[model samples]
Target: MFFGCEGVCLSFGGRRILDKVNCSAEPGRINGLVGPNGAGKTSLFEVMSGRYTPEQGSVVLDGEDLTRLPFHNRARAGLARTFQSPVVPSTLTVGEAFRAARKSHRPYLSKHDAEWAARLVHLEVSWETPAASLGTFDRRKLLLACLVMRRPRVLLMDEPASGLINAEIDELDLIMRRLVDEYAMAVILIEHRLELLAAVADDCVVLDLGRVIATGDPLTVFDDPAVREAYFETPDA
Candidate 1:
């Protein structure tokens, strides 16, 4: 496994949020993590990314144990994640933001490197444009470009397709494929959009009420009765 969490457990206010969950991603493949709202998908992401310390189990990347490392240290170890909202510095221009991302850690990157990363994601806005002025899709592309500039080995994306129009989603779909097929990075996606997963995911792990109820190809996993029930169940049931 290039990136994964094993036997992860988390709780809040004495209520279990995750229960011995195991999930992984492989290089050159897109692993889809899907479940209904409040199914613990985002919570598991927090544990894997070191934002929340699990009560048990560990987060591993390329055979190295990172259970105790902080989020910055995990980023240094080639693990990068995107949040549900695209956060770009409102005070900085596109060029300034990219420069900061380039110089964020050791082995500082160059302008050419930043340009290459921007081109990889088809970010065509003027470098002088204010980041806060970008539209939703452009903002997303900008953040993703920044992460790619660091050359991470694993990318965890949370609801990346959210708020995107159909046309924009098509563009994102292509970018994701390139990230896997061309860059060979292991990509794990947390998404509610099943069509996107069905089109791109190599495999999927479905969680329900803090437990994994199915694991297989997207088509097969989506077909599982347990998964269907979970998705369709009434909130107050």
Candidate 2:
């Protein structure tokens, strides 16, 4: 089964944010979304996650039209997401944060599930340590750990590579590539870094100014003339 948007369109104050955008994400495959800033990548994420309703399109999950479903209902449909930055309680410990995020998704979440997520992110600190005590990378990892607790059918991630060092980036790349197989979920990753996409994504779609400019394997899409122009059409001096 796959999850995605079809002909999704949206706008704000007459300025278009998405135009007939279509892309599908399937289980056991990582779908990458790459484009210049303001290319509607995050906007599309919002639509797919039920934060925004497209003016003229539907968000479908396994043949059920989720276009009008609320975000909570969408979660019940096995859709999960992570933001550009970590949003965790400063006072809560690692385990507590995961437990709290786990509550709405499952009536009871075991320590094993939390440990599995922690291990996925390579978290080494004690579960009792306050979230505020962890470094940026660790806190971000905790956020990811929280999202994976529910084992959603699809996961939408925005800028998973942000604020990570080289080693951390490498670790995250490994985790992402394996997540699909381990969890049986479709993953949609949105980021600006081409290297990350090439290293992990099975396929990618390129967007520009609210419209799709190209879609294919990550390398092919990135190499498209339109994509090159969008980011690096400037004269080589």
- State every prediction's TM-score relative to the real structure: 0.97, 0.95
Best candidate, TM-score-wise? 1
User: What is the C-alpha local distance difference test score of candidate 2?
Assistant: 0.87
lDDT of 2 by residue, 53-93 (tens): 99998899999999999999998888889999876799888
TM-score of 1: 0.97
Candidates' lDDT values, in order? 0.93, 0.87
Across 1-237, the per-residue lDDT of candidate 1 in tens digits comes to 668999998999999999999999999999999999899999999998999999999999999999999999999999999999998999999999999998898889999989999999999999999999999999999999999998899999999999998898889999999999999999999998888999889999999989999999999999988988898456564
Model 1 CA lDDT for position 83: 93
Error of 2 at 31 (Å): 0.9
- Candidate 1: misplaced stretches above 4 Å? 232-237
RMSD of candidate 2 to true structure, Å: 1.6
Residue pairs with backbone overlap in model 2: none
